[model samples]
Target: MACQVQLILAIFAALLAALPFLSLNSFPIRRLLYPTCRCFPGEPCWPSDESWDAFNKTLGGKLIKTVPIGAVCHTNQSFVPYDAAACAELQAHWNEADTHVSSPSSITAPFFADQSCDPFAPPSSPCSIGTYVQYTVRAAGASDYRATIEFAKSNNIRLTIRNSAHDYFGKVTGAGAIAIWTHHLKDINVFDYASKHYTGKAAKVGAGVSMSEISQALKQQGLLAVIGNAPTVGVAGGYTQGAGHGMIASRHGLAADQVLEWEVVTAGGELLTASPSKNQDLYWALSGGGGGTYGIVLSMTVKAHPDEPTATAFLQFNSEGISTDLFYETIATYLHNTLAITDAGVGSIFQLSSAYFAVVPILGLGKTKEKIDELVQPTIDALTSKNIPFSYESTQYNSFHDAYAATTVETPVAFGQLGGRLPPRSDIEFSTTSFTGALRTIAEKGGLISGLSFNVSRMPDVPNSVLPGWRRSTISLVTGLIWNNTDWNANLEAQRIISEEFIPEIDRVSQQAPSSYMNEAAAREPNWKSVFFGDNYPELLRIKKKYDPSGLFWARTAVGSDTWVEGSDKRLCRT
Candidate 1:
């Protein structure tokens, strides 16, 4: 026994000696290596008094101050003052629970209102008004949903289901509201694999699943599906509402187009499912009417593709000595070439900046770069003949997820540390104009253009699926200036110039295209309804009225909030 103990001690000492090297090798591991807090382990975590005070001020009296009945509570005054008693209780409960629980990571810190604003604000924005809250929910299946609904109803509070907090219109979370962060609702279940309903296979994904997680899961199952980059964006929210586009759009269709069914909670507190055979109207509305305007989605059942061959190409172009005339010529030629290649199951996306340009093209349905080259070589030759300096690289993947991640660029937060500045504070404003005909003329005249194109091959084959107003045009383009300084007047002047002077110049040359992608929209569009929702406007408004009669879901740019609505809009009654 003495000899065995000595040997064990020697091995332990050796492992300890290697600890520093392991830490150095795995920096990400360090981020997850925080010491456990003192709060009761199994109970819900609570904010310190200082944290709560800061959060209360930021909310400006929007939250309920008292704890609800049967809910655990704690009061620590700062990050340093963790409630040991609360942590202990929670830890004990967690150990006894049969289900799996994610160990708290550093990324799960207090979410402050000020933190939200900071990312949305321009440079040097104030942080004094920022506040945060920390909350936790126990792990359960259907029972968890019952508890959540009951909690909200009993507390007289509204719940905002947030997965990634990546809502472009800011509907995922709100100031001073109790945020039910759903990132913990990570469950992925593969349903029937031979059902005609899904055209083969489908998966029911929990609301909190991220795009990256879904992609990895599908890959493991020898299947693929449409998803965006920015690994952290929620699958149910972003993909569901924005009509998700991907590299394979020319062949497969938008993300919403492929959804087989959805499980959602209406504003009236009813949990429902939307699909072709059930609640079809709700299914249509939820597809592209923009999320939060109808109901909160709990899970989504999406169509999946069997293992299939895919091809991708990345081409880079430098504008060093290229004249504005030549640049415009290149863009026109590229668009024309893209339209020509669609028949061959080909689609391309052009990413342009003031200094450089990159084009990503995808060929679906078991095609190859060699075949892609057969169709695209002419366009490539044309650009090269004009002395345009460019390079191209192409490869093939076994699935759609791999092809998408290879082509999609990471999205920078509009106002976060990643993107330089935030949206302006004063009356938030935006402008847009459409283009047509004279693509070359505008380019030669030095019109700045930033364009993105996706072939909508897999979109629902139904006629009315792509809203009427937006269907007239095939390509969508946006060009604008982001103002960072606090000179409100100057920023306004710049905005006017872009809207009236710059965009009109392009419109004059190209004629008026008259359509835009609702997801990448400008707030100042005169006929936003006709532009974004197209023929679906009336239907969306009806559903909005039915589900949210009180108009409690409206935020900065949420659907159905008539910028013109008088004081009739107010929070929903928790009764």
Candidate 2:
């Protein structure tokens, strides 16, 4: 007991000692110092194999040693019969699709983070252990999450919360760390949700539940959920954490806006409930401030809307025969008409490629098909005047599930990077020559556009942390670069251009200080705090300090994660 007290005192002293040298650009060394009070990995003080074994025993053999999922290619001995063909196929699968790698709760896609982990590097690079978590506790229940948090806290080790592994920013895995995988905690319950702050018919879903699972499950109850377009995304994970947006968001608001409460385990090793009334700060932080930062989410109760008939529009125009100038004018015209379309109760995802498409999911929900057509006539007129060939389809569905199933376009994963922006309404339809020019400049960048009806007339009854700009923004604009997976240089180049070139251009044309959707934005975005959370960032940081002062949960580019950066070793280092 004496020794334990002394140890605690020493640690506190060390932390205070490390604080004086700290600045926004520099992190305290104590942040990374392990149990032995060491400063470096090779100084004989790092956690040893014996220590790991003991830790494993404490968890009842739940500790998992890290292995490169792609190691089959390099090592054929001591495991299985060497199959070169099989190894090559595995690499191909890992390279091309986020779904394959993101499938395993512990297996994060390579490109999601900085791709700093050497294990997922090109074949030419020697295979080595990456910055990935050395051990993961496959948490099946809340008790497991609590235990992991306590263990990490006592040991002064970093903790990472992983659910679904679908984060575009790769918050799921961290090297030299122990992970709590919440993917198996898939309990979804339906009941009358009553809270001091809110009362409604709601579904309380475990942290691991995906958007598709929720959508399909709600379909059985004749209900609708405002979920991201991708079916594979985790509904209760980073999606909600980063203020989830979708085609139906204009009506129901963001997925985060749908939350009534959350069950969470904080860094203090206490399981708590966060809601509009209970633990309100944590609730605000979890609502839209960011994910993998506040605490490990056990489950979330969200308001459920009764399913309604949806008018779906699937329209496409070919790029051939139209001059580049005419195409630019067509895009400007489309932006010009967004105000009326958005006002008429519609939400859409527009693609600007060889064959441009605007797939409106909840189209003219309270109006007629003719009304929807009239709203879109200006753009159609421009296309027709240019003699542009186009295809069009309009139908009504009993549920959003049916509409999405019939009209959804699959976006296959590739070696790519994505950067997003929320374009102000004035840019969309102010109709001035400069505004038109700015819209053209933005569209000329040519990427997927997912936004509609940001002209919200009313705000949420209770104040929370969802980014302030989302209430006024007209479109959620995205610009990205997809490259050949086999060529790693091209992958690196794509990331460079996304941050250095494309994002700046988007910011310039929009004439804003750059705000982005946290989940879908670039990992290395400059001035990320205000850009992701806007005026809410400072309050969110206060909540983070209150809940996780030790900075136990760190996702790359997450709120309050500035003290550390990823090193070439794939390990996180003090800045």
Candidate 3:
């Protein structure tokens, strides 16, 4: 009788232990009966298997597959379904979370970087209730593009296109939705160069091609294009959308300014070409309308320049004895002289430090010290006159491509997979401030100064072609602060205080300045629409509404969020 009682107790404990799993699978009866799960508000509601099957058939090919909603919710890493066992394991993990049952057909999965920790959707906050759905699509080529857009419209699903996934604001991918990964659309086509009105030699490149690949291709052709310093940044998507500027921008203008034409898929699902001649409205919009706002760009035809001999100089200066006033005066003089030499096709970037400053000036000249000096001397003279202690070195290369390859630091792409690596170890935060002469006083007061400024004077003189907020001036200056202390909260607070206090001071000086470069604009600004688009905001809004009538693309700091009201020109957050 004792042995029998012990056996009965053991059986009862085992049964009790299994109860949670049983209820987990059965309480949400939808999970057992349906193949997909949808979450509304907070609960997991299951969708019928038949609906999922029907949706899969519409995707053509085996490209669209279903995974248990439970599998996705629990995994911390990027969830790419490769097999059933993995899917089951993922589902079991996901079952522990508050997930809804929804068919994969109607769902769009958000692609995340490897180290991301934020829940895919924004919490219910003062702004809007973020949505999370579970369908993902990787579309490439013309046919896939059409099908993807059509399916999205038919199902009222939200879609986001991701290539290198390098967007700083997490705009490239999202949660609980379909993601159209375009990394496979890597094609480089050199059309009839002369027919495209190429005075020298230019090429039409696909959206998926990266700067590194394009740089190599152009090198083979003895040609070069204005590309960003980072090799991994996508040429068509990154460069075109951000109004890409580079070391050569002062000589050739912005990457977008060189665009001859662009093949884009509009909100209406039509593949169309835009240029100065065709779809003029879109041409203006795409020039610097910011990414994924108007439409998906398929390809771009941009101006190319012949490879020319070039020289690069690197100078370092210790700000040890420099007063804040002296530093500001010196910088002001440097800007004045730099602008005066704009016609010489001289471009220089100054990286400041709290205790030091590094200047990398690229001169478009032959491999001769005299030519290089002639290009760089004015700004160098200003620094020397200020009695600023500094060291200088120079090197000449066969071409600008070679010079860039040798001098420009390569930013690591994999770091992006690690929760978007923090900006260089500087105390500065980006701000959209017009440069005025306030630096003279700041320099006298011994304030810290560090940042970069690029001259875009060589950009083609296209009417209304400047960046929206940049209409006030010919030269744009980017100034920042460097914090030497590691008090995280205090440093952050200092950065905010510096940005808020000083940027407005600078902008007050350069009241008539050019538009802010979208790449450098503060992500916290509420009036980013006016700050980025300038006069083009109304048109962008119209196009956005046309393509995303349901406003599915709305996300934090995205192109079409309501936070960017028309004329709210004040900074949004303090930190």
Candidate 4:
């Protein structure tokens, strides 16, 4: 007993002596203790059940504890019991965008989802929420938005705003955060819009309104609004705020150019209207400043144009009978005429692979079938000259909606990495060799190339914070590197190739400074400030500070995101 008491006293003395030297800044101690981060799950600061229950009551019982849809595949999960039938259904639709969009916590980009609860994994494999938001508030109105922002801010919880979850950069999901799911806020109203800036027909759409829904609604009213090329993208969310482009962008302008007013709930929980005449800075920033940065958007009233006749065409060719050099030459010829086609009031989207090239649709607004044929004849001639066998089709529709429905390829949710660049007209017209050579280099590297070519310069100039590169830019080229879901090394290599290989090749010949569509860009983009927002970044940052002083909203590569760093544990903390 005496010996044991002496040993205990000696250990206590040693600990007390070492306590003087112990420091919070020392090695692993700093990381393990006193981490200045947002409250994470299992932490004492995390909200209690009583607090959550009270908050749910405040939201009118809208709060939902996240249960990953994949839970249906795993029997071990306590929150969800496995069901064989439901698991089969989920596995079938795992790759579809709607499967994720319709869910409260799922995002289209699985890479960001951390593969936490993959439905296709072994049925016995454990299922956890992983990086998905822990709680979601299905926000239906301004009150819900206000309550969510206030609660997240007060609780020091990371807040994510998700509508449709069609984000490519994982902007719609965050770990240890609570989300305001605006998916059910599907309100649409069409009216004769009159504003101080101008007067015209317009539609007020909810944040959750998808492009397909708005198009169908407006088509019935004999009007149309500039929407995303993809049918599932939300109009008033990231699509428009990131300066949405569509088939008719050359004729009408980007979706940002069409905006007349925005109804948003600020970080202070004050609902405000942003337009040219009121809250002008917020209006300017929100138009193209990137979503989930400024505030939670309730709805947007945008200018709608009268429905018009449109012509659509499709062209497809491959390298079956042609030499590699000849195939590239044919592609080069078509790419060189991008400016001319857009100048003639036509826009087009095409897919290019090492062995295949297909222009799914060429949009000719206010033009006839013959006009579209004339515009595409040069490309057809190129293929003919090379003796390349191909197929071409053309059709004229009474409305843009009809043409869009026929030609718009249903974009599936791809689990891959995407790197993008906006090659200006000057480069395509002058440095033709270098421009096409870069694309060939990327394709040769097993990268799939997707191109959207148009002239935003042709649109009515509306001052917004969209990438200035869009003004002079003729094409937005995205290079995709897909990898198997189970292979971590392959995924890392794919991302590395896009960040280190594909983008640099294009930059060599790109006339403008490095710029890309923020919504569809590299995960590890360098100098994102200038690349995504350009000279407008400084002003955008100022507006972000003014509206969201607490940094209540954040996303990957968003405005002022540099102010914080996501920790090793995925808890966002001040750098």
Candidate of highest lDDT: 4
Supply the global lDDT for candidate 4. 0.86
Q: Per-residue lDDT tens digits of candidate 2, residues 1-575?
A: 98987787578567657887542112233333333321234433345678678877767777776655555555422323444576667766654435443433334445643343233444444444455665688777777877787766555455788776665676777656678877667777877877666676799899888777888888888877778777766788888888888777767778888898899988887889998878988988898888998888999989888877777666676556777666656766777677777766577667665345454543644445666677778877887887887767677676677776776544455445677787667656564345445444545555443444444434676666888777767777776766444567776776776777767766666645667777777766877888888888778888888898877788877878886766665566556
In model 1, the runs with Cα more than 4 Å from the true position are 1-126, 129-159, 193-198, 361-365, 415-449, 457-466, 482-513, 563-575
Ranking by TM-score: 4, 2, 3, 1
Candidate number of the best TM-score: 4
Which lDDT tens digits does candidate 1 get at residues 1-575? 98986786566456646776543113233222211211211122223456446544444433334221101222312222234465455434431211111221111111213232222233233332122222323223344444554444333333445556554334443332344455656899876654435466788898888888888888889876777545666778745665665555556767788788888777666788888777877787888677666766778888877757777777777668998656655655665666556546555666555566667554554677677776677668878899898888788876666676676654533321100001111101111112223333333433344454555533364322344422333344655454432344554554565555554554453323344555554434556566566667887788777776755454434567573221212222222
lDDT score for candidate 2 against the true structure: 0.68
TM-score of each: 0.68, 0.86, 0.69, 0.93
TM-score of 4: 0.93
Worst 10 residues of 3 by lDDT: 418-427
What TM-score should be assigned to candidate 1?
A: 0.68
Clashes of 2: 2
Ranking of models by lDDT? 4, 2, 3, 1
Task: Give each model's whole-structure lDDT.
Answer: 0.52, 0.68, 0.53, 0.86
Clashes per candidate, residues 3 or more apart or on different chains: 32, 2, 33, 0
Q: lDDT: which is higher, 1 or 2?
A: 2
Model 1: C-alpha RMSD to truth? 18.1
